[model samples]
Target: MRPTKGKLLGILAATFVGQMALQVGVIQDYWKKNYWSGQGFAESLSPDQTLLQLFGFREFLAGILWVRADSFFDEGNYDAVLPIIRLCTILDPKQIDIYATGMWHIAYNFTDEEQRSDRRYIPSALALGKEGSRQNPNTYELFFETGWIWYHKIDDDYHQSIKWFRQAQERVDMLPARRNLLANAYQRNNQVKEGLEHYWKLYAETAEQYEKQKDIYQLFQQKETLEQNLDTMIVRMVQRGWLAQERGEAGQRVYDTTEPFDVGFSARVIVDEPKVLRVQGTWNVLPVGTRIRIIVRDADNPNFTLAAMDWDGQNEVVLDPERDATFMQDQGFVKNRRFNKRIDMSKDPTMYPFARKSENYLVEFYYNPRSASLHVQDKFGWNGEGMTDKNFLRTDVRKEFEWIPGPKAGMFTEDWKLAERPTPPARIVYTALTLSRDQILRKGDWIDKTPMVQTSNFDASRFSVTTEDIIDVPTLRSSAPSPIAPGEVKKTGDNP
Candidate 1:
């Protein structure tokens, strides 16, 4: 059928226009998704701008903001940089550097600035690191950086640091530096078992690496240092009574207190024919005129004083010829007591009744100057007959000590026994001996001017050492076999 030309032309033009409009919409959507989603584009356009104007430039915008943030950081305008950095992170959430650098600036640089009084800075920095990790869950750097902030910058909380460090460690990309930091954190936190585990792991790995390299000399040095550290840690644990022991052995424990004074006390219960308790340790460094009072009392009844002693530093006489003669003359024959003493319970009859009681006891060492004054006057023949001003300066110390015995089980009256002590791991002792052997061989050559012996053929490698060949005694091992790898020799040497 014949149609009008005007109607046909109108139809064609309308169809072409609609097709163009559809193409324009597709282009706009692509631009928004690929380009305009980031912070730079958002900043470039006005807040009231239409959605079309805000589309398709986010990555470019994020890059621009990152540059500006870096400049702000260099200018010491940390506060100004934070928002920009945060915006950059939001725009490009996968950028690991943004999170690490931003958090570092906030936590370290900002807090270390001259006007560092803003208490909110640290927590805010921590929050930012957390958010960054949340945004990129697979990244280990963010977690490690966050842990570093907690360990070094904020509260020196090893627990929090170790937690995050461990999280980072779970990732395969974790750095060796992070592992070392974790080991240190364990040691500093007094988690000795964990520390030893890490140390031994590191030692084993280092030995394996060094053995392959045939860098035996450096390996010897490294092993020696590690063994020394292990020995020192063991001694410290034993002194602190952290190590387990049998019932008949001495029960030792160390206490750190901050009530009457900042001091540490090591108490040991000697399980002899007549069990005796000994308490002793160094106290806080005090001023010259400071006085300390040591008191033992029944835990259940504080009124019952078991033993008492007064230490007056003012009464101390310096015998050094270099001191002022006049000052020496003024201070009488009473030696200056530094508040370090080993008090024996068996020798003190007054302490026997309290010790025999099933209830626990308390030991207090405090700064009581007035009490010291009274003791000084009586002992030094002053009699306090004419002295009008009896008031003496008193400084309150901030440490208190208390000890309690184990309680009987409820409903069944049986004496509570100490928990079994953990036996030191066999690998630890084996490693120590191996290290000691290397050290001795190295020193023996140096001293006797002999060629270094082939360590592989040494008798110590077979763990066959006579008493005469023993160096320092290796720590006791558990009943379990040593974890030393097969073909790895346990060696010992003469003490050097």
Candidate 2:
């Protein structure tokens, strides 16, 4: 049957619309499988936004949303940024900056009134980063970002971090600075040999690049850092038996980790003035990089303490901004076997309001072997296995991340309890003390004579630190010998 002109035109228009819809569906399905599979299309965007995306304005929409998110961030409207970041990622998953920036904001920017990061957001940040990596698999930035989340934000999960960092390092686009993270992850995971190899390769590459282009001062600077790190690693490795027989090189001293190393770790805090503290301690470790983390906060405030990673993202935990807001934390480097730091909370009234007068204050000192220098870890094995303290010795069993190396370095067993298990990582040794409000805020200056083990006298003046000291690596040797003599055992004196 022959149709009229209007009817024929309408029929053609309908057929065209249907064909277009089918093509759009096919394209979207392809995109969903290959990229932006993080969220369902309808779930992530409104009708108008979806229509805009249909017109190939996905990146445009993403940029606009990211700008809006940045505005929200600048305004301190952090809650509003989360949904925007989610939308932006779904809109344009390939925007590496959005993923990196959004992940950082989610992981670190969401803090409480006390400035402690809301750990609940960490899972979201990690999820977002992983999704971005899935979308942009060829890029190195998102991989690096995800690695950093695990490396730093997720409580020394070097095993987990190394996977992402290694992936990032393999990519040709990875920045030179980002490459160090992979090396660091290797060392932190107790893969000292692998870490040293990576450092040397990276340094050689940087030197070659600098030789090619002498105008790039940053490369030279990078080479210097690489050299320093190399020196430290070499020294630590030699001292700890990791580099025992490097062909033709013998007579190297390797310390025995089976024997306990008495760090003689003791810490005391004295209030020098209103809202000011003098924290002094002796770790008796000769490593220059060992640091004591000191935290001063309201006794009732638990947020000041480092919390384990919350992998359970089923219910997002929100932080209360109003309650327990005052907190101060500083890390003091152990120099000459001693750590001393003057913490003045008098400044930044907004940060350290000291609002709770009636409540007691807690002063904590932490020496996590995970965070200490490799040289320090030579005496105190990872998880403080070989460390002993007379007074403030603590023991706690923590989950160990076991990873199979080679091509499957990142893969882990579904069940952490493997049939043939290695020694369960144990004992996170640290130190702490508490004080009444009167003692912290009102008491005058006084020295705290706490019963702490004092190591045998080692002349610290003979050993001095210098930039050139790195050149004299072999000369350093075990000159700053063990805190306790080989025959002497530290007295744990009957202090219950």
Candidate 3:
């Protein structure tokens, strides 16, 4: 009870030091190394953890509040955003934005990405609005914000966005047409038919969510007059005979060691056949903002694989295009992998290549190179590194096609596109030239002209080709590249 002043002071200092030590290693700093690890802590951390930290349940989380706050804002989880702010102010009362907006509008109505711009925060937002209104009641934004979230960001009741807006001195009036919003989402997704259907549904449901609908019924009915116009004006791509089947030309050629090849063959290989292209590149137009990956490797070179891919909207897509090699900052994952990799990270934005694909793409990276491996992979879709599938050169084209190890699993199909006669049903074909580097180097030196025979996974008894169509394919041979003089090329040492 009778403690000396010096003793009391010492105890206080110790407590302060202890608090700092524990805080230094908090969740915020725990991921300083993973700043750019593509996946951030928030991605895995339960929203509750973020909320507790945001509310100041833990002192160490302060460092990452801004980012965490932004993350919450981006998610438009208004229900959670407000509570966290209330807790935050208890710890740091003067945090202006936290107090001012913690729940102001759910984004105009906050959403997974967009702010419920029209909606305002619940109790807290209302409290602030009340306070703000007293000081500047003439301004309407504060009052309207409350309703914005209720109308749009929540279950999507635009009626509320309008209601609150009306209470304000000035209103945005027209945010987005209720029906048009759905239409826009569909159109943006390239689902025109679906979008049109929804647009009509909206028209039928409400002329305008906020406006009158007496005249809407008459106008919407007129759409029936343009029924024929609903049909797409785009031309159809039609082929005849074998062109319609996978008889050797169904899938896009990843590569073919055949010269104007037929559908089937003995073994899928190049026995001194210079006429056959070693590998062909069949590209896929990747969507924007989505992750993607592609891998091609030798049968023997299992340590690593050489892959080329397109990202619909990563760093590569943002950077200006170049004539030489475009820098691909983003790397995607393979869906299937036998091993697991441990990764450490930091707090920066992880970057990768992202290019919007307007249509089918074609980017050939390697040639009739050698090794013992033959695989193709794309994993961005999966949470893992990526997906991979093993392919082969076969001697039988009529057997059965086995599903490769990864995505789109099925039976293997030998001589998929190089076989003759019996055409398979395919919209496109995928082929790869399976040859060793040593074998290709001896293209004309020690090669044989006899076509190799192979077996296929196809079972005619299983109903030849299914009702489902297959991707069209082609047999392509690589063109010889002109020799480049080494001396003419500049080197790092040459610059010096």
Candidate 4:
């Protein structure tokens, strides 16, 4: 019963198709069942890691290599997964979903749980994304992933944006959303020609969003520079205690949680003129409670104050409204978890005490708290280097008093837990200046517009800077404080 010519041809064609379909289905099923056994990935691990011991080598040998890469990557076997992923991609470059998902899992995982966390996966994801985009050139998702990896995971090179733009521009009908995304990448990387071209195309071609021309127009508006500077200044102020925000006004604050604590906020009393207060026989002229505004022209801001007292570490121990805790009224002082505002001094035993001269001290201030949001901690004894109170410090954060009483003279403080920590003196005393006008500028104006600094007949080394004398550096846009003459030091008796 031989079939006719047409029937025979059709029968043969059907048989061939059926056999090929069955073989492909069987191969896919086998791959699905054995691929992610976790052991095969162990074998493919690089020599550096020991994942094989954790996942098994028997299962690894029989598994599809691609699945091994994904599991190893998830397990933080960065070095191990790279080779496997590479091999898998080489074998099946056309597997679009695998290329996207597997590479992403390995490349973008950012964890440092044991210092063994694989933060280096971003590059692997980027490499796979790029390969996928090349293989599936018409696929918008591949190019989108590539652009994302390049824009975020890798160095955001402006030129790299062009590649993604080209991929999205393929003649194989692209989705409007993906089309717009390509335009955005172009703008981000500053691809002027392609960026503007697509932007306008988006405006004219479809009903997606045409008024977006304003976005393109505004993007070029020096707003980026302005925004960038705004970011930097916010960070700078936050570090200086002036600004308090998490992200520094958007992007300027590049937070490194691992960064060691620096003395961003401190009150440095510079002994510019050590001899000025004890001026030749003018002892009674300035009374005990005189408040003098302070300055450190060489330093950054108002966090530091210069107060003069007898050269003894035993200045009045006042209530530390910022740190000291109070259990009762006169019996117990309330401990302030945080105090941004400067408090006035009173007759409290913890009030201003005479800080010893001839020997200097630097007072370190920190902000992070164990429980509270606002805290002022001392950061001096943190590194375990030079400690004022060795036992009072935690391994991480500690505060210390830093100042050179002399060339090599350092003050040592005992970790005394008095009932109440002494509060700052009620008066502002100008013991000395940090930098003189001559030191800042021989001729031009300073960053501060206040009183120009000058050496005084107090004939002392450091000058007593009247609030007016402290001026800004002309270079930076700051107001100059009105000048106070050398002879007319503001008296506490005078209305401030």
Candidate 5:
């Protein structure tokens, strides 16, 4: 078995080549499974051609195209840059910034060039973003970009925006900016509960991140500021009845649903003057032929109904002192008339004598279907003592009215204020405790001395309240009474 030197050398070379081949095969398999999963590889490229075979060069090509696209963007050649960006995506679909920039250019920059009127650009950007997300399904940034385009560029459709943003939110790599955007979208769309939930989530996440940092003084200051902001948001939401607490509830209820049935009762005081108190809003999603009553009353004398009329849910109702004759024969008696009257408060001295007096008034809107009922009452007051004549009384009384939804519809009430003051509930305390824990020791030694938390998280589904929760929270109440002249009293009470 004594071989020659050349034969032995050949044998050794063959064994080394075989080992190298095996190692190469193992590496290729790993790359295929991990790096190139769900991605197309150029089959024609040779294994030995490292530059063409690797993913890095594709990224480099994309970068080059990105620079070129930027130049085209600077030149205001939006359409021209799109094709270049498209090619870049093909070269490296996983590049998140490429998709974000391309979508932004089409959605915002290009649309701005056309004064936001061209609807074509929005869909184009959305399509590009979706394609990018399709190629890189694991990335959150691409999904966030799609949501941003839908929210800001498209027709302000928060529903569609939230759909994509939620997808981004599900990813663990979600940024604070993305979370803030999602919260803003929810709030804008009147999904207050969901918005508050996300805000609290953000607050917790931020606190957790801050605790991990080494700086002590900066952390304390930041923590204080963040806690204050969260408290303010909680108070505002509770005061507005966006989040309400019930006696048996585990947590406050979030008015998160957007169904018209959920928003069935809404009203605004369009005009509040001495002569007339006009209220206008919608009673959406009520059953067909539902009876809605519009009632105006003197705030001083709640018993006296200034004006009352019944309306079917088919059309909008407008109650004006000047236009009542169209529906009435005498002052208070409503004749069998079907006049479609519009709301206009023109100066007609003979028609609206109540408009001349400077006093407080109450407008109530009552919705009572056989199955469901709702009431929204508003109070508006005026100080007319200083004004010499009724003509001098200001007619521009555009006070905002507080529209409270009924308890049967799952709306919250003023009870949240009481639940939060002096001591916040267990849920809020839990949040503070969790956030205050030190990252190193995982201990909350300073928890007891922590500032009283203003917000809490309760199980909204556990809320069970009776009709008693439906309290009449007045919009405006005057402490002083205005002295009325003898002649003015008759005019204010008399029918139009």
Candidate 6:
């Protein structure tokens, strides 16, 4: 059959347009690899997905996978979502939410029988965030997430968190609230001098924002918080410096080894109703905002926590949703050196099945100085340097603390003399208490009406002085403005 010339021309035009679109997609992908996402397609994508990506279908495919991941999450299929999350991020690397939410799932979703997070996955979560930051160098949210994980989840590694928060603040689009976290990390890391300086800057910035937008309540609130934090830090700095100077003049180190604050950790359990109990405790710290982490779970159940971060899409996803049948957890904050919390495991049978009534339960109480507030850290150091617990005091070697420069004289006159001696070593000192099922449930022969008290008596012999006990404080800025008022202050160690 003879075809018309016009029909043949139309066919040629359609073919040309299709070829141009394909070429444009390829060019766009090339630009994305070199400049946008900072990775090649072959490194992260499967061969089939690579082909799809070349056709500009990466975002679409990533969206579809994200939807599937959400579905899996809703169905309690947490393990299945990891590979999907990985692929989605690789496919559309610019999507920040995937990195944030995916890291959260990996770090927190994998739980044990007692609902304790499988902490082994934390490093993998950190790796994911680091990779995300590499891909999105201009964005601050991923950097902040990385800092948050270190600050909260990675055992309160404030020194590590400071690194990421510093980077996050470098970005121009950083949020004002997130900017304050940098100060918090500094404070927690025992770099109170740096923290105060940062707080002053943030306070001034927020004050400007308040002047510009008087109608916005958040700006005013932020300004107030910064002001309060600055004031508190100043007071603590003055108090600590005075104490240090007094000790030094008495031929002692900056921190006295002879006198240690006794943390009399005690607990009481009162049964309010079936499966409901009031847990109260007192610790001998005169600071507010300290908290104790509490965990109540079946004692006999073995920890069946999986530690793999299988984002390669080749590994099988296996999880047992029934592991958390009897798990309960809470944190009680201290007010006036006392903490009380009520736990009601009566609701949501699916979440708290309490299926193993015959088996004993374990109630765990723990307090870490690294996770405590700055005021607490000021008195106790970052590692319980001035604290003693007779019953639950435990010590272990940790490698997190690093040496920081001693404070030089600046706004305050006392810091220079106090900084002459070394700071306390960030020794891993902690207090912990565990209650058996009989003790908490009032079952078997352990029934008692009196509150259970675990007093830590001081033993002077235990704290013998040693030359190797010297520790380092946080890095102090060479010069800082006075927190009381805005004025140029002399640099530390300057000639008067």
Could you estimate the TM-score for every candidate?
0.40, 0.58, 0.21, 0.29, 0.40, 0.56
Give lDDT for model 1. Answer: 0.42
Q: What's the CA error at residue 233 for candidate 1, in Å?
A: 3.4
Q: TM-score: which candidate is best?
A: 2
- The list of candidate 3 runs beyond 4 A from truth reads 1-194, 205-496
Superposition TM-score, candidate 6 onto the true structure: 0.56
lDDT of 4 at 363: 24
Question: Cα-based RMSD of the predictions, in order?
Answer: 27.5, 9.9, 23.0, 25.7, 25.1, 15.1
Q: Rate the local accuracy (lDDT) of all candidates.
A: 0.42, 0.64, 0.30, 0.35, 0.42, 0.61
Residue-level lDDT of model 1, residues 1-496, one tens digit each, is 8779998999999999988787686876777555443323354334644343334665577788899988887787866887777676666756778878877776555331122322224555666676665555566788788888766654323455766676676666775445656765665443557777776776686677677877567666665666676676566445433453323333343211101122221111111212122222222222123233333333444222222211111121111111110000001111111222333333323213333232334444333221224223221111111111112211112112111124652211223333322322111000000112112222343343322211121222222222222221223323443344233234322100
Q: What C-alpha lDDT does candidate 5 achieve relative to the native structure?
A: 0.42
Tens-digit lDDT track of model 5 for 288-362: 222333433333432232222211111111111222121110111111110011233234332322331324334
Model 1 residue runs over 4 Å out of place are: 1-60, 111-117, 212-232, 244-283, 286-496
User: lDDT per residue, candidate 3, 135-177, as tens digits?
Assistant: 2334444444444433323322222333334344232332323
Candidate with more favorable, higher TM-score: 4 or 6: 6
What is candidate 6's lDDT per residue for 349-430, written digit by digit as tens? Answer: 5545556654555566666676776566667654566567666655442334532323552211112121211444444434
Better candidate number, 2 or 3, judged by lDDT: 2
What digit string (tens of lDDT, one per residue) describes model 2 on residues 288-399?
7777766666766533343232332412212223333565656777655566667776655555667775467667766667766655677665556557777666645244
The worst-scoring run of ten residues by lDDT in candidate 4 lies at 326-335
Q: What is the TM-score (0 to 1) of candidate 2?
A: 0.58
Candidate 1 minimal-lDDT segment of 10 residues = 324-333
Task: Tell me how candidate 3 scores on lDDT.
Answer: 0.30
Q: Whose lDDT is higher: candidate 2's or candidate 4's?
A: 2
Worst 10 residues of 3 by lDDT: 334-343
True-structure lDDT of candidate 4: 0.35
